[model samples]
Target chain A: LNVNINRKRKWDIGKLIYMENVSAEDCIKRWRNEDVDDEEGGDSDSDDSNEEDFFKKKDENSSKESNPKQTIDLEQFVPYFDTFEKLAAKWSSVDLIKNRFIRSAVERK
Target chain B: MSNSKSPLRIFEGHQNFRLRIVLATLSGIPIKLEKIRSNDLNPGLKDYEVSFLRLIETVTNGSTIEISYTGTTLIYRPGIIYGGSYTHQCPNSKPVGYFIEPMLYLAPFSKKKFSLLFKGITASHKDAGIDVLKWGMLPVLEKFGVRECALHTLKRGSPPLGGGEVHLVVDSLIAQPITMHELETPIISSIRGVAYSTRVSPSLVNRMIDGAQKVLKDVGCTVNITADVWRGENSGKSPGWGITLLAEMKKNWCLFSECIGDAGDVPEDIGAKAAYHLLEEISRSTAIGRGQLPLAIVFMVIGKEDIGRLRINKNQIDENFIHLLRDIKKIFGTEVYLKPVNDPESDDFIATVKGVGFTNANKKIA
Candidate 1:
């Protein structure tokens, strides 16, 4: 049964949507459990601990963190765009954020 | 049959032009790309892309490239792979790695011994820096039966004011097709790195190394990293320090990740982020991580076997990768298959392909 579901999931290619508002620190913390937000508390509006708990709960529910909003880590843009004006213009700005949007209302496997 | 013989088609505005061009050249298939950013202002190919095409021409003989006056359309006809000593002044706007990555793919297959002296930014956050390639790509080449390949960073160049230089020498050998049926579980034997500082205080390198090593140790990885501090002429026009970490597995496979210390970016964060990437790769059961998948796929597409397989992440197979896979199948008739696994131990998927069994153009008829 799991294999059948796995086969179905493999065919499901989610369109990559680059989320902009999410900062690099937020991504690293969420991905690696860095817990930097607890220390800095830079964005006073959002409670860091509550957000972490939310992520952990969601992650447990689904093995893969299937967040609709994906952040193309700023680091990937390098080497390729360092000096190329076109690549820099294409990927450098917030275009990644503009590129993809979540279409499916229901997260179908 | 006529349609199949036609040049492979590519639309405009795609970023992997270099990869596509190299693939076309290696496969000896003509390719035509049109509507290159047609709707955009200052559309067509960029200065760096043109420079990249010129470099591709230098490595090959009689390669034909045609571009529209507005630069919106272009056609490329590949030529023989004739590699020899070359000295190229890389466009100041891009790091040398942009040129180096493609050069690494084509060098071993050249008829003559490939020796190159590249002058430009040696290390940048944008491309795989010289440090990353030396540890990551060089070993991969060696694994594929490429011998006597040497990658050296002669000088360190930073961005904007890049004057870095690198000398690479690869033997003239026909690339023997390889079959890497299964990627062994990555047992990180050691974590090695270079904390390089150019036109900056040597202490910066130490601080970066300390920050990076702290994270590696915390993650239970061997902190076997080293530091390289350059002064005066060796350091380029700009002042910066960054770290490049190479996680060497028990097998020859290497996973490299790096970050640069930019304005407002703390050196410690740069070091820690690079370490985190290495930890992420080590944590994965896949043979290649996201960083090296594209490069590995390039080899798989060109191998002499009828079939090749490797374990990889499904998320790693992005749009550019999909484009490349399709192009390879069209140009070389290689069929690629992706199989997903539900194993609780590893989330990685299996990518298998039947190669076209392409041999070098220069191979003597026997």
Candidate 2:
């Protein structure tokens, strides 16, 4: 199927990685499973689809990203409130660290 | 050197805290504590998007795990961007601005005993990285039984090798199913102790060649060596061959030792072109055009992608890549075969040609 992908395929390795391996994500969620919002609770009826969408390939030479709040875009695409709640926390900590450093550096010392 | 003979837990501080799981035993495995304490990083690099892991761990008989950053760099860095800046002065003198991303790690020892298995890493040693490995990981591993230190290269070009162009170098090893011992000795010896530099020089290449041989000899192993040089960087005049030479290097190494000949004071780009055209002949070979073989070198690539970095016109990547492969095959002729494949971790072009390795002004190993 003459795949006309503009994303350079020769050097892009996203496919070689195990996108479905739940260790890294599970590790984070296993810890952040506490902050669940019952109001927005949703069963992961489409985890397979979510996994597929989350792993959709992107452009190669891309250089920009969406805002921080929009960080949940990948998660937003996920129907599992459970997975989202935890991953959000795990990722938030990372953001917290980066944000703290950037803010502090931009401010005083 | 044996000590307490128990499991060890180690950690290092980078932009992020990377936890390493080590299994040291006939059965002893490292159990992740509910809490892992790590110091956070503040000093940072601009244009940085993703966080890199600085992992350290100790496994007693359970299984020894080694996070070798040095190997990661050696395999990948040599094929990355050509112009690597190295300031001669203080603080700025350390101007290397590239990092490697890791995928998975494994220690294949059946019965772990005093073993330091560095699964993923760059060959170049960062001051901070070494400090963590040596101080934090070493002592911890020693407690369990990490006697010999061994590491493997996971993803190439992610960390890059000594920076250069005139001598664009990459490697390909087509072998039948080899045992761990056979692979380990050669792999370990190939890059036991190495260094990096942006400028490509014959002296440096010779040194690496010599070092490789010595390491292999010391490890008591017999192996063959083939180097395909591609000199197509910033070279403007020889654009056609410059790019072609790179594709060629994926399956071949330069034959000339002095490929970076007198630039004749030509423009850097022109010199670059000349260098690429002449790379294969650097250490000139009388049999320039010889019989070809059918072989394909496939590499998976990955990298940080923002919103609109790439535009794959067609649906699948393999489709687009096949076209490039056809072009390469046509250039190299019918006898020779070439294909390009994408990996999941890196986002660089990997040219796969039968029975050959690929190289360019900058390095990329897919």
Candidate 3:
């Protein structure tokens, strides 16, 4: 029975091998899922995401506290889930588009 | 059968164990403590450690709280060495032990800020779920004396998944002790009686053989050396071993160390220098201490590109290592041994050098 197997598994000290022995995909998947956990779960203050948020929060908080008048979106610097590689590539291309508008008559492409 | 004064029944109730004072605060979960032997075979702590443990007395500070957490929070450090199972499992799984003093100030929100924002959750909710973790961190704090929390799994629910964390605090005292038992022991494979390890990289394997050759040569014992890497599909840089390795010799002991880095083609001289540093660090650790210093030193050097690019005019990498081994014999005493690794491809080598030293010296003159 599954119950019996669960008990056997529970008592087995060797189950810890699974901890040190996760698959690469499993490890990465687990790592990536941290973001999703932070989104759905509180108590997260998830380190994976809050780095930028800390700076933005500090800036906005200071602004609001000091000026007594600024509306800080706080989200200005915190972008959605794009990897560092993905964001870097996308930003370069978007900046290129802005640069290309210098003269529509001639296109480098 | 003697008189009433016979021996007075010599029952001085001194429980030799420095109060098993289980400091459990915050998480009201009740855990029964029949007895706790540190999972490792440490007979007892050294004087300094015991003296430091005396501080726990001041922290436990005559509190009547049945269980008082020595600190505000807990922390865990997931490094290349400690790996995963080295972690203490507190909850979610049928728990075994509890963490004692967790410095709590660098709260969850503070630990892995990057991972948190990725979830795009409100700070309040995020703070509630993973930020204020009460368990899984006490030992890390008591061990390393640092502020960083990586959460693996902390909640109580279905699909209960969690990660570990680390962070810094403005001012905190809960020291994170880096448990040494994790690395000092050799991992044995359940499948075989002989010690089995998977991540003994090719170069490291060669170095181990080299180091072993010297000691074996000196002792007049012929030994077999094997080599391989962890092919576990999930395996990358860190490979987990199944058993702890202790040499089966009578009077000799061994110390093994491996360094992995972007050491771009370090020369033989540099290798010897790195060897010196690694040896110094291993000798300094409270775990291996002086008792095990004399017999053997095994270094497992790991790197793909670094080992191949290394070159010395006098001899090949193996020969250079042998020279270093011979040098070790010249210095302290002529009994040190080695297992120098040679990685032809990518210039990586792992050497498990071993030696015999006179551990009876009384002073710290050196």
Report the C-alpha displacement of residue A28, candidate 3, in angstroms: 46
lDDT tens readout by residue for model 2, B67-160: 3332111000001111211111111111111121111111212122222222211122221122122222222222212233322222111122
In the order shown, the candidates' DockQ scores are 0.05, 0.01, 0.01
Give the candidate number with the greatest TM-score: 1
Candidate with more favorable, higher TM-score: 1 or 2:
1
Q: Candidate 3 chain A — worst ten consecutive residues by lDDT sum?
A: A9-18
TM-score of chain A of 1: 0.21
Over the stretch B174-230, how does candidate 3's per-residue lDDT look in tens digits? 212122112222211111011112333445434433432332222212233344333
Residue-by-residue lDDT tens digits, candidate 3, A1-109: 4233222221111111122223222222332342123333332123444653553454454434433222222111111123434433433322222221122222323
- Residue lDDT tens for model 1, B1-366: 012365556644444577778778888778888877676678898787888888888888878899989998888888888888889888887788878888878887777888888998876756778887787787777766676788878889888788788988987486555765764445555568888888877887888887777665533335566889888897777877788888666667777778788877777767766766555444442556665666677777788765777877644555345545655655666656765455664456677776666677666535
Candidate 3: global Cα-lDDT? 0.23
- lDDT, candidate 1, at A95: 26
Clashing pairs in 1: A78-B126, A78-B127, A79-B126, A79-B127, A80-B126, A83-B93, A83-B94
Report, for every candidate in turn, its global Cα lDDT versus the true structure: 0.65, 0.21, 0.23
Q: Model 1 misses residue B295 by how many Å? A: 2.1
Model 1, total clashes: 7
lDDT of 1 by residue, A1-109 (tens): 5343333331122111111223222333342224422433232224466764565464453433322223333124232212223322333232222111122223223
Q: Is candidate 1 or candidate 3 better by TM-score?
A: 1
- Backbone clash count, each prediction separately: 7, 103, 105
Interface RMSD of each: 16.1, 24.0, 29.5
